[model samples]
Target: MASLELRNVNKRYGQGQADTLKNINLSIDSGEFLILVGPSGCGKSTLMNCIAGLENISGGEILVEDQPISGMSPKDRDIAMVFQSYALYPTMSVRDNIAFGLKMRKVPQARIDEEVERVAKLLQIEHLLHRKPSQLSGGQQQRVAMGRALARRPKIYLFDEPLSNLDAKLRVEMRTEIKLMHQRLKTTTVYVTHDQIEAMTLGDKVAVMKDGIIQQFATPQEIYNSPANLFVASFIGSPPMNFIPLRLQRQGARWVAVLDSGQDRYELPLSVEDGQSLEGREVILGIRPEQITAANEGGPALRAEVQVVEPTGPDTLVFVSLNEVKVCCRLAPDAAPRAGESLALQFDPDRVLLFDANTGERLSKAPEHIPAGQSGNIAQFAAR
Candidate 1:
């Protein structure tokens, strides 16, 4: 396996056109799985194409194992890519398809046969080795495509939404299989997917991209728990982080956010230092749905009128209004209240996040620390 790095890489279609990939810098360690995740037209595919040498980078360097490869052709890059379309030849049997790459490199017929059988067994498709692409299911076709890549044993593997075409159940199955295969082979891999679940589950590191720029590059948990910007926070979660727009108010020495739910006002503590700059400034209170829950006995609570209740089997999402903004709270199915019911909701103050309303950037400083509460109001809120 080889380590791959992109240094200030830029891509553009025309001389004067805006770049499709802008000043990209990333490194994937050997035997590591890196996920490039973003929405459509976010340049993730373009970045993958650049790495695979299918698209020429407009500026900067692409390196494999610390050796520059920007000038090399795709075949010489020593990378194997599984396309979104599977791209298996319709007329070729699974064995031939898997062996095609080795054969092109002039590998002996016996070696090709052995490699084909090995990958077929590895992918659990040994029984379908003689079947053509047209005769197999979509999931089966995807495995064959993967087998083709595996047979070559390239320095790195590039998976471009390899599971996009599979059904939901099959996608989950294939995801597990891919993880297992990677665990056994320990090959360096770069995966591009629009699915956040796949991004969170499959990668050792994740790069969240948008409009040709990487917004955040970190571990999945870091990306989830401490997103760099509002866009990253809003994009990574399943139900999405709830953004409550409100103005900050200082209560003695602490900066607190006030929430109004039509019935009453609640003061949520902030971790930022005591400063006049944030006082009266508009900011978004960013909290995950899972972070909000039914108030524990005598714990901090906000009286909210439930507007909607959506039961999603294992958990129920409770929607309520705070500061005139709708907020979603994930609660245990058994404890979830119905619509129109008045419930006391509690938030985890330590887990609460703040973002600049206008800039969409996180407001707190790095290595955030929570200070002691300076007001009786905050204590009362915590007790209620």
Candidate 2:
């Protein structure tokens, strides 16, 4: 395995002034699994192509183990890529397809056979070894494509949505298989996907991208817990994080967020430290659905009219209006209230986040009135 580095990498299709990859910089340790995640049209595939040596970077360098390989041909880069489309050779059998790379490298016949057999078993395609690509299903074809790459122990592996075409159930199974395979091989890899769940579950490190720029790069836990900015907060979570616009006003020696659900009005306290910076201003209050819960002993509760309740088997999601913005609350399935019913929602003030309404940037200063653990003044930090 080898470490991969991209220093200020850039790629532009034409002189139209728009860059597909803009001054991208990242470093992947040897044997690390990194995931690239973003919305469609965000230039993820273009970046992957550049790394594969298929699309030459307009500027900057690509390095493998501290050696510059930007000018190297794909054949000399010693990297294997499995694309979304299973670009298999239709004329070759599964065994031959897996052996093609070894054949090109002129490996001894016996060794090629041994390598193909090993990958076939690893990929669970040993039974289909003699069948041609034309006879296999889409999933089978994709496995063959993987086998073709895995048959050789390359410096790194690149997978571009390799499980995207499979059905939901199959996708989950393959995802587990891929993780297990990575753990066993300890190979350096970079994978791209649009699925948030896949991004959270598969990657040891994730880079959230948008408009050709990386928003944040960190471990899955850090990305989910301490997002650098609003974009990172909204992009990495399932059902997404909730943003509620509120008016911040100084009440006594503290600043409080006045929340009106059209049914009830409540002042959620903020720490004097956090509220000190926003004496009288409007800001966006961010929170996750899971942070809001049904009433527990000694918890702060706010009343709201439930607009809808969705039970997703594992848990229940309740949607309601807060200060004219739709806010979600995740509750235990048994505790969910029906639509049109008024429910008292509980929130831990320390878990609330404050952001600039216009710029959507997080506020660094916390309020002082609110205690370290809970709040009765103004809601303070929003746990990612």
Candidate 3:
């Protein structure tokens, strides 16, 4: 395994056309699992291709183990990639396919046999060694692609959405398998995906990219709790954060956000630090759906009629209208209210985030760094 570094990397197809990848800089330690995630046309695949030498950068350098590899050819770079298409030889048996790379490298027959056996057992595809790619399932084909790469024992492994074509259940299973494989092999890896679940669960560090630029580079937890901008916040979460547009007001000495539910007006006390006076300034209050609860706490509660309720196995999603906006609240299945019923919703003031309405930049101070694997903040909204 080797560390991978990219400095000021830029990519462009032509002189007049726009740059495909902006000045991108990133560092990955040896044996790490780094994920590059974003929507389509975000330049994630371009960056991956650059690292593997399939596409040369217009500027900057790519290094492996502190040595420059930017000028090297794809074969000389020694990076193995598992493509989404599972580009396997249809006529070649699984064993032959796995051994093909070693054959190209002219490794000893005995060593190639041993590597083939090892990765087959590692990927649990030993029984299909004699079968051709046409007889194998999609997941099996993907495993063979990965096995072929593993047999190379390169400095880095690049996975370009290797599971994108699989079914939902198969994708989850393959995700677990990949994570376990990484743990056992401990190979330095660069994975590119558009799946949020994969981005959050599989990577040790995640880089959220958009429009040919890196938006945020940090741990999954850090990106979740303290997003640098509104785009990062809106992109990473599953249900997504709710952006409530309102202006802050100073109720005497403290800053408060006034919420109107068409029936009652509730003043939400906010914590403003660094002497940042936000009175009479319009901003977006960004909070997760899970942050808003049905529990009636005394701090400040808004009375709103439940517009809809959806039971989703472990949790219930209840919808309500606040300030002419539809708000969703995730609550316990047993505590959920039916449609048209009045419910007192409470907000966690400290956990609430703020963003600039016009610029989409984070305006409120981010919460303290949440330790990995720890639950988020406890609400100060006490029951009356």
Candidate 4:
């Protein structure tokens, strides 16, 4: 396995047109699973194609194990790629398909047979070795495609949305199988997917891309908990983070956010200290749905009428309005109340995030201040 690096990479279609990728820089250690994820037309596939040498980069270097490989052909890069379409030959049996690359390399027939058996067992497709691609299911065909790459034992593997074509159930199963296989093989991999779940779960490190530039490159937990920008925060979560438009107010040494529920106003303490500069400045308050919950005694709460309730089996999503902005709160199914019922909602102030409304950038860190009548670690304020 080899560490992969992209340095100052830039791609442009024509002389006068804008660049597709701009000064992209990323690196992954050997045996790391790196996921590139973004919306459609975001240049994710183009980046993958460049790394595979299918599309030549207009500038910068692509390196493997610290050796430049930008000028090398795809066939000479010691990399294997699996496409979303499975790309299996209809006439070839699974065994033959897996052995085709070895054959092209003039490996011995005996060695090819051994390699095919090993990959089939690794993929749990030993029983389907003799079946032609036309005779197998989509999931099986995908495994065969993966087996073809695994048989080669290449330095790096590129998977471009390999599970997108499968049904939901099969996709989930295949995801687990792929993770297990990666754990066992420990191959250096770069995967491209539009699915946030796949990006978060499969990658040891994730690169959230947009407009051909990497927005943030970090571990799944960091990307989810501490996003670098509003775009990254909105793109990576399931229900996505809730954005409430509010203005900052100076409350002594620290800042506070005022939330009005049409009847009462609640002062939500903020950790930021430079509130004097931000007073009267519009900002966005970001908190995940899971971070908001039914109010508990002796803690901060917001009084609002339930607008809607959706039970998703695992959890209940309750909708409420604060500061005229519709907000979603994740709660236990039993805790959710009917629409029109007034509820008191609590927030984890320590977990709350603030963003600049104009630029969508996160605010700089400041020391947290505990509200009156609350412990140093917890801020307690309620609205009714």
Best by lDDT: 1
Candidate 2: residue 333 lDDT (0-100): 97
Question: How well does candidate 4 score on lDDT at residue 288?
Answer: 97
Query: All candidates' lDDT scores?
Result: 0.88, 0.84, 0.87, 0.87
Q: Candidate 1 on 86-133: residue-level lDDT in tens? A: 999888989889998998899999999889888988889999999999
Where is model 2 more than 4 Å wrong at Cα?
251-254, 271-276, 365-384
TM-scores for every predicted model: 0.94, 0.91, 0.93, 0.93
Candidate 2 TM-score versus the reference: 0.91
- lDDT pick, better of 1 and 3: 1
Best by TM-score: 1
Candidate 2 residue lDDT tens string, 114-165: 9998999899999999999999998898889989999988998999999999
Runs off by more than 4 Å, candidate 4 = 273-276, 367-384
Provide the lowest-lDDT 10-residue window in model 2. 375-384
lDDT for 238 (candidate 4): 85
Please write out the lDDT profile of model 3 over residues 225-327, one tens digit for every residue. Answer: 8776778889988688888899988877777888888888888887765478676777998888899997566656788889999999799998888788888
| True-structure RMSD, every candidate | 6.6, 5.2, 5.7, 6.6
- Badly placed stretches (over 4 Å) of model 1 are 366-384
